[model samples]
Target: MSVQRRKYDPDFKRNAVRLTEDPDRSVQEVATNLGISKDLLYKWRRELRLKEGLAFPGHGKEALTEQEKRIKELEKKLKDAEMERDILKKAVAIFSKAPK
Candidate 1:
């Protein structure tokens, strides 16, 4: 059994992909500057794009972390307070219109 070894400098690949993200730079130019195959550069670029917006490979984490959870709770309380104020205003208006 033989384990095939593939030699690749990931730093160059990462830099090439990062520079390629700039609309002003050409992929061919970045690939050449990074001294890697344009094909590999494109593959890395595609991988980075695909990886975006995903928190992890599997089992997405909660959108609200602990601090965010507290913030969301506070926001809910504020919204409820505003709604209660509106209700109180309507109640006062109704009472003021009633006869003595």
Candidate 2:
């Protein structure tokens, strides 16, 4: 038998982190009340602090900063241009060959 992992939505994670931020509440106290591991809460807090608005991008989704998004777009365009160049080179080579 396997133990299933629990999934928390972005809102729940943000709220949990927010709860941990209360001046009167300890991290362990909030984690215990929320039924999550203290380590998990700490990790969430770290992500929230580090990523700010980009934190908790949800499952199967990536959190990319604006510059990162632009870099990704430019990388894709470069790859496409390189592929097209390769295909054109092959076409030129074939056309330049003498007919048998």
Candidate 3:
């Protein structure tokens, strides 16, 4: 049997992370009140701190900055070019062989 993963909206995640930021509330307390795991709340808070407010892009959502998007595009183009070059090399090797 397989277990299905639960999906939370970006707003919910952000709010949960925000709750963990409260000075008066312990992370465990907030997590219990929110009905989410303490570890998950900590992880979200860590990510939010690291990203400086940009966190939790929901599934299939694009949250990359302009530079990050450009880098991803370039990386993909480079991968495609490398694949084409490899195919061309293989084709050249095959055509250069002698047949009986």
Candidate 4:
């Protein structure tokens, strides 16, 4: 039997991580109160520290890394170029068929 992983909400994770940040409460104590592993709490804190501006992008949305962002940008450019090419092709066909 496979052990199902639990999914925590963004707010819950944020709150739990915030609790770990309190100097008065040790990480182990906070983790026990939140019913999460101490390692998990530490990992979340590390992630929050590293991505202070872009942490927890919410459900159904991916938090892209630098390489992924660059790839997404390039893909958009390619799509725009393809659309322009199609439009120009149609225009050329229309003009060529018109009486000179």
Candidate 5:
């Protein structure tokens, strides 16, 4: 039989995270009392850290700013210019090799 995963209350998670900060009780003890696992406690701590102003990867919102749009446009133009240069070089070679 598959065991059902239990849901923990937000307050319980808060207390569990707080208990981790206490020198007296270890994370495992707090988690056991809260009817959860040490790993879950650690996960909760990570979530708490984010709420406490931690910057986790890919967590920040990105709305393409004006400067960023301009930079992207410029990069595309540069690529187009390179392609044009290559095409011109090929055309020059083809014309130069043709007989009059």
Candidate 6:
């Protein structure tokens, strides 16, 4: 039997990270109260700090920074251009063929 992992939403993660921000509350204390491991809380805090607005994009979704987003857009454009070029090449080849 496999133990299923629990999933927490972005809001819950943000709230947990926020609670650790309190001056009076220790990370261990907060984690204990929340029934989570301190390491997990620390990891969340690190992601929140590093990713900021892009953190916690949830399951099956990517969290891309501004630079990453731009790169993804450019890559998509390149793929489309390459596909069009291939199609045009095939068309030209077919049209250039002499009738039997």
The prediction achieving the highest lDDT against the true structure is 6
Query: What residue pairs are clashing in model 1?
Result: none
Backbone clashes, candidate 3: 0
Look at candidate 6 and tell me the lDDT of residue 89.
100
Candidate 5 positional error at 16, Å: 1.2
Q: Could you tell me the lDDT of residue 30 within candidate 1?
A: 86
Best by TM-score: 3
Please, what is the TM-score per model?
Answer: 0.40, 0.75, 0.76, 0.61, 0.47, 0.70
TM-score of 1: 0.40
Clashing pairs in 3: none
lDDT (tens digit, per residue) of candidate 5 on 25-84: 899998888777899889879877865533222324433557877998999999999999
Off by over 4 Å in 5: 53-100
Candidate 2 per-residue lDDT over residues 1-100, each given as its tens digit = 9999999999999999889878999999999998989999999999999999999898768899889999999999999999999999999999999998
Model 1: which ten-residue window has the lowest total lDDT?
A: 53-62
Local distance difference test, per candidate? 0.72, 0.94, 0.85, 0.86, 0.77, 0.95
Positional deviation of 10 in candidate 1, in angstroms?
4.6
Q: What is the lDDT of residue 83 in candidate 5?
A: 100
Lowest-sum lDDT 10-residue window in model 3:
53-62
Clashing pairs in 4: none
For model 6, the run of ten residues with the poorest summed lDDT: 59-68
88 Cα displacement, candidate 3 (Å): 1.9
lDDT of 6 by residue, 1-100 (tens): 9998989999999999999999999999999999899999999999999989988999859898779899999999999999999999999999999999
lDDT agreement of model 1 with the native? 0.72
